[model samples]
Target chain A: MKGLTLSQRVAAKTILVIIFLFKLRNRATRKKIAFGIARIIFALSPKTRKRSINNLRIAMPDQKSDDRIRYLAVTAYQYIVFGVLENFWFEDIEYTFEMDAATKALITSGGPLSIATMHLSCYEAVPFALQKLTGRVTTLSRVPKFAAGLHSVYAKNGVCCVDKSQAGAFLALAGKMGSNGVVCLHSDHFGSDTELDFFQLQTGAPAGPAMLSAYAKTPLLIAYAVLQKDNTYIIHIETVSEFPIGQSPKAFQFAMQAIYRQFESIILQYPEQWCWFYKRWR
Target chain B: MEYNQQLKNVLSEILNIDTSNFMHSTKLLGELSELDSMSIVLLLIEIEKRFSLEIDIADLEAKHFETFGNLASFIKNPLTV
Candidate 1:
């Protein structure tokens, strides 16, 4: 999103057209068509393909055999592509919310909640679905300027998108949480200052999820929306420790590690669905 | 000394760094292993809490976080102009 040529932007717009057209088809058909488009993109984008393979190698060192890693890389691309296409018609995708009793009580307790999540299959749907249960949900996301038109549609829904580039974005997030709103943060990527052992690799992890939860004294939870073969999404929610008031540096590190641990486990389970093309460890 | 101690305490608390040895010459930003984009934000948050000043990320530059002295000056008066 940082660097995009005019042609690339036009190409993305063209893909959006195809995504819009696919919306006319049935759920299963659309998904199949989306996967087909994704496969083609996977084949064309060598950078993404290579990055995915590299990521898998780093995260899953025991996963020997190039063929398996290659397949997973391509499939990961397909998931990323399908995720983009699905966002066009996310309303059509049937979804169910699943969480433990304590997690459910924390969310429904009528207090502010902070959700730490990753860019998994249908990751955008996490907030989209959560907003159905929780009244207003604000998410920190980076939508390229090219797709501003499409993202505006998502903004029309209760899920407000805060551009990560904006100065003092955390202030907005903290304010949202202070007002008893749900703030969902995607922490899978390398966007922050703190280092954590993710997949046995020390990587810079965002301090947002922990800092926000601690500062706002909100219940922190980790969640994901996994796309099933039946064209349905199951949003699984679990508890990340609630931020104790006046969180110390040790507590912050522990919280960050806890979030990443859950993320690593989820990625291990659905390696193909997680976006692995990015330089996650760097 | 009051503001300096307060700022050091904040940096120590957020970054888990022992700031006792930190002095005016203590380098930050690229020089400090713990100071990065994420830590910068955390530092800003902590600075706001300790010093009661608002930091506009848009207005922030590398110089503001170059050294402990710079950061302390910024905290004493967060004039990003």
Candidate 2:
């Protein structure tokens, strides 16, 4: 079979939407159908399947049974599908956060604070919900060219998305930080220029957040919204420390090392929920 | 006062591997499967923490981390004459 053209892919998506609208009244059936479609896609992609299994094996080495690993892999696939669906219709979703006073205080502090999050289940909603509760939010994100419509929807919902590919994006983010705006970034993803670490065998992670905080003289806040079995969310927020203001680049790098240490702790705690299939430690 | 031993200790801690079988000539990337991209970054961070120095990503080369001795030498004398 030939590869799908851009217009054909769009048309296929349109058909899926039409089917979704036709089954809108039957929400449970729609969810089941979505999950079933996801399972089919998951099984068809050999590379994704292999990567998912490898990730499961590495993360849960103690679980020796193939059945267990298979279960986790399937769950991971379901999560990706459901997450994409949810993100598409984020405005209609309602989530509850078990936030402590300290978490709330950190957001309300009105300082340029940096949040380091991973690509976990419902990761996008975490910031969206927070901005709705607290106020406007600024987040560094790599905007997908094909998802322009979805990106606009997120923007309409008040998410200040900064394109990571552009050099000026970093400067803009730093300027926003200096002006006492909240800047949230996903620190776990690998990049071409990023430094590698334990999350994967060979990974490259962008040092933008660290660089921004150091340059802007802002406090770094480590935040993640962990999905619970009960279908509720826990927004884990902690004020790690402030970057040494007016310090040398070396001092800033040291401060970033400390921040990444804290990030490693969180990723280790919930390894499965992370985007492990990513070539993170590569 | 050999820097190789210090480098070994740091590697052992960072990679969470026993250094008993490790030698100065041990290849960091290909030979040791544990010294992956993530581990490499973590090792860099740990080195920076321990030595109080900064290393740019541009400064890194495969040769710099090819062997334990190379890494030690780089850390000991990062300046190029």
Candidate 3:
């Protein structure tokens, strides 16, 4: 086995201690620490500040003011920090949803279900909450190279993460649908195999979920967890039927677009909560 | 009766541009000027909605989007033929 160098060992020990300290802190303390980190990031990173402003400009073309943009950028940074902290504190937190009977019926039905989720406030918390509320839950996510420990935490919580980079991951995911598992996936990010036309721009977005659903002859449900002013999340669940069973690929892409349009509407409503740090249009 | 022309008409309407100005030879990105990344995505959505087709990511190629005529032809009778 390869041994760690003195610096590497020290860094590893420091990170371990930080993680332990973070876990030991109360929720309020975590929020304060996250907010402090956000403020520091805002003060230090000029590029991120500029990018946030540019993102808000594109998202809201009509709203033009330096002060407003700056405020939005700061708020977005705070949200990003809070989101990260939420991931750590998610296991202890609880959420309440006011889903309609129709939505509940679709969720309770023992069949393959696909959930379309965007990067919203405490996005990870939604699935964690769902696993607590509904036992069957899985999420399509790219495995982070540095976050092997985090993956184990997610696994412990019953949230299955599918590495998007794997060749046959989509196929395997499609096969899993037969067991009536709830697969939650983000359709916003750009992917090499994806066709363009997202967020009023030409960029690749993976069509795997839509294609998998079409192939499996399962239902695709659109759901998003948005944070309200009072810091509670409202999970909006809606079923879009534009993409019928056995429809052609183009029809499925169109259906995906309709779903994306709904996501855009949600992002517009809460621009600060959206993950603007990502190169979304690119 | 060719599906290529019909597809071109649909593309023109969605983009709010004149079909008469578009040619089979005109490229989508640089040549059309109006066909940006967002437009391309919107066009794909419109195509899927109108024609009931789903496009795979691996199937996309830059050359496929090079010309209006090329896109029209591809959509009219995809390479699957």
Candidate 4:
């Protein structure tokens, strides 16, 4: 369009490419092709690869071998690349959900919930699967300007995707929580809101999940997914807080620390699946 | 300072905005350029300390932050909500 901004114009072209990718290839073939191309990109992107390796070193200080570190970093990139590409054809993917008894009751009983998730393998699978069962899953994402149309993809999957770049995105997410909706937010990223210890290092964390759970008078839960060998995702969900956090700022900060401990363990368990490319210690 | 002015000072400090000119009807959440999810955390913490009130109540919500007046009222007496 004559009046379209540069990002909007690029977004239009990018969406066309996404649609072409979705239409021309079968799901398996698409995944294979995506993985093949991802390897090339990962190889070319040394900065990204180096960052992941360095993050892994900080997180897993015991992993001393440089060769091992690089291996872990490359595999993580593969997972990240495929996980991102799967969003283009999410509806066609397969996944299985697993929750403990407490989590089951909390999720199935169905009230307002605040789910804190990570950038693990097939991270969106948690929300995608939940939306399928509850039809109440809402997610807030910082969609890049070039991929802004991905909002419609989330809508097609029945996920109420809110762009985090917009003003009042916080209020929108909090509103959803107050309205008996399951709001899923990615919490394994560094932020300037509340300070916490992640991987034994002091870093700020997003307080949205804890704050929303307290504000909405609902339980806060953490969920994650890892892709299995058969191209199926296994989603695991667990509770981080049952009662509403009543201690205000102290309780809020405490709750985030506990969540980070859990996240550290999960990321350690699935080293090749969790995203370590972020400049987390900063 | 009155609770309202105290609240305004906290908001201005946290969001790095000039709320001295803000009226009761002035919007806080969406309209303010610096008021994002991260800054909201800082604001809530500061409000709890300065107002001596916990922001953990179920009745507290985004709508309360719709305008400066509503927030000031909520901090003064949440039971009004």
Candidate 5:
């Protein structure tokens, strides 16, 4: 707090207040609150709103109508905000797991693996639920000073939370995979490790999941959560590449492209759930 | 020294850095500006392709990539380390 700027302090305090208020309400009421506040935040932040629309138009050139794009942007922001707020009070959030028979057997076997998750609705639901099953779930999060509550929530869920800002965070994640631990990383965001074709546009994506899977000699799975009308979440986990793959730029790009393909399908299925504000197509 | 030279060649190719001075004891993560997050992954890719070795990716950590020698050692035999 001492090094924070005036606006940063205000933002942090506002988040704390939102977290506190969210704790006082049920899931249904909280979703409604989050949606309303999300709208207000969207309206107030011109830069964010503009970035969201710009990204949408770039990624979704087929959407000709401005109104439809704006609507999609707002709803996506609402879902992202709702998901972030849900992390603070995850103890009460309801979610169900969806994985195939082979994945279940593999997970139940408690073998080391890498999970690539997106920033969809309640994205952390995958790791949270996996911890309940295998008790070996590990997640890497950029936990700043203000997001300590998020760190605590993961701790409370019996998930090992590693700080991404730390020097050896990637090491910790890989080490977790080395020791039969399930490592889940959010891979939807921008990165320079691997070039990918996302939303029909060329973009750079993190190669951590694919690299870990191939280099560690483990399986790779892509998971996402869809928000339900009942305020519950349905988390879907699908294997991207389960078998061994060659370690090379070509192999990493192939694996990452496979992931981007799945992401495109999920985003198309739930247009209002994926974040559109990311500077995805640079 | 041969393995060290091979590792240096991989690093030079992936990172586009002059590795003439690179040695087994050379520091990587903090010392080299070119060995960023992306380079780290690219390094592994090239290491596997160059050596025809399937590295145990799960066994990788920061220390494994901290020094040129560390990576060479791990790639030589991860199970022993």
Candidate 6:
């Protein structure tokens, strides 16, 4: 922290203040405060509120009521804030993982696997829980500072992170996956010229998981952790690559489309838990 | 420009736009509102189908999609780029 820039030091201090405040409350009170803060942010920030509204409109055009869509947008904002607040509480809480027997076997086998996940509720917990099942889990993340905070709590919890901004980062991730490591990728964002159909609209979807699985010659899996009413998280994991992994770009497109279809289904099921403020379709 | 008619056809279909006025010098990335992230991806897929070449994500750049001519050249010979 001595050599850090002023902005970084301020950011770190803000995070510390959040954690200290979070530490003052029990789980139930913390959740209530988090939800209240989210509501305030949603009400205050017109940009996020509008973006969420527009995203939901594009994602579900036939919903037929603006009020319903607006409610979902506000709840989505709350969920995102709640997710951030819960990051401070991950170490003390126990998350339940729900998957089929085959899925469990695939994760427990500790073989090479690539997981594609999104910004769903408590999405960060998927990798944390996976590290418990397998001995190691690696992830490509963009934000190093945020990850550093989580690493302090889950210190050496077998989660290896590589900054995605560096050149040849994908090669490094592929090398890790080549050695039978589980690499978790946040794949719900847009990438140039990597198109896939999501919610019947065309948008750029990351082809990393599909391409990495093919390169690594391992099964590609999709997982998401959603929050329940009882202040607990339930992680759902599934395998998407049922047939032989194809190396062609066409194969990558097909695999990604299938993955987004699954993502859309999950979002539709838990609309409030997903991050709709993101310009996903744009 | 004549060699790019097939390219224009594929682009129009994938992007759901009328290619009546799109010249080889037409700006794509910024000028066209239809060429957002999703259409850009479908544009690559359609280019792959029309040209029988597979374009990797690494081969993609803003310059390659700046204009219709640039896009056509990339589709014609992606590996050399």
User: Number of the top candidate by TM-score?
Assistant: 5
Global CA lDDT computed for model 1: 0.78
User: How displaced is residue A16 in candidate 6, in Å?
Assistant: 1.1
| lDDT accuracy of residue A101 in candidate 4 | 92
RMSD of 2: 11.8
What is candidate 3's lDDT per residue for A43-148, written digit by digit as tens?
A: 7988887777777777778886888878778877888778765775566665677667777777777667777777776777766766766787778666444444
DockQ of each: 0.12, 0.02, 0.03, 0.30, 0.49, 0.05
Per-residue lDDT over B1-81 for candidate 5, one digit per residue giving the tens place of the 0 to 100 score: 578788878888888888899777888876787776556766766777778776555567788878888877887875432
Selected candidate, larger lDDT, 3 vs 5: 5
Per-residue lDDT value at B33 in model 4:
65
How much of the true A–B contact set does each candidate keep? Answer: 0.07, 0.00, 0.00, 0.27, 0.60, 0.04
The sequence of per-residue lDDT tens digits that candidate 2 reaches over residues A116-149 is: 6667766887678767876757787675554455
Candidate 5 chain A, poorest ten consecutive residues by summed lDDT? A143-152
Name the lDDT value of residue A119 in candidate 4: 95
Best-first order by TM-score: 5, 4, 1, 6, 3, 2
Better model by lDDT, 5 or 6? 5
Which CAPRI quality tier does the interface of model 5 achieve? acceptable
Q: How do all models score by TM-score?
A: 0.78, 0.66, 0.71, 0.85, 0.87, 0.75
**Candidate 5 structure quality by residue, lDDT tens digits, A115-199:** 8899997888888988887899999889777555566789988999988776656777767877889888999998888788887
Clashing pairs in 5: A215-B57, A216-B57, A216-B58
TM-score of chain A of 6: 0.94
The superposed Cα distance between candidate 4 and the true structure at residue A169, in angstroms, equals 1.7
TM-score for chain B considered on its own, for each of the candidates? 0.87, 0.82, 0.75, 0.87, 0.85, 0.83
Badly placed stretches (over 4 Å) of model 4 are: A1-3, B1-22, B25-27, B30-81
Q: Which stretches in model 1 have alpha-carbon errors above 4 Å?
A: A1-16, A243-246, B1-81
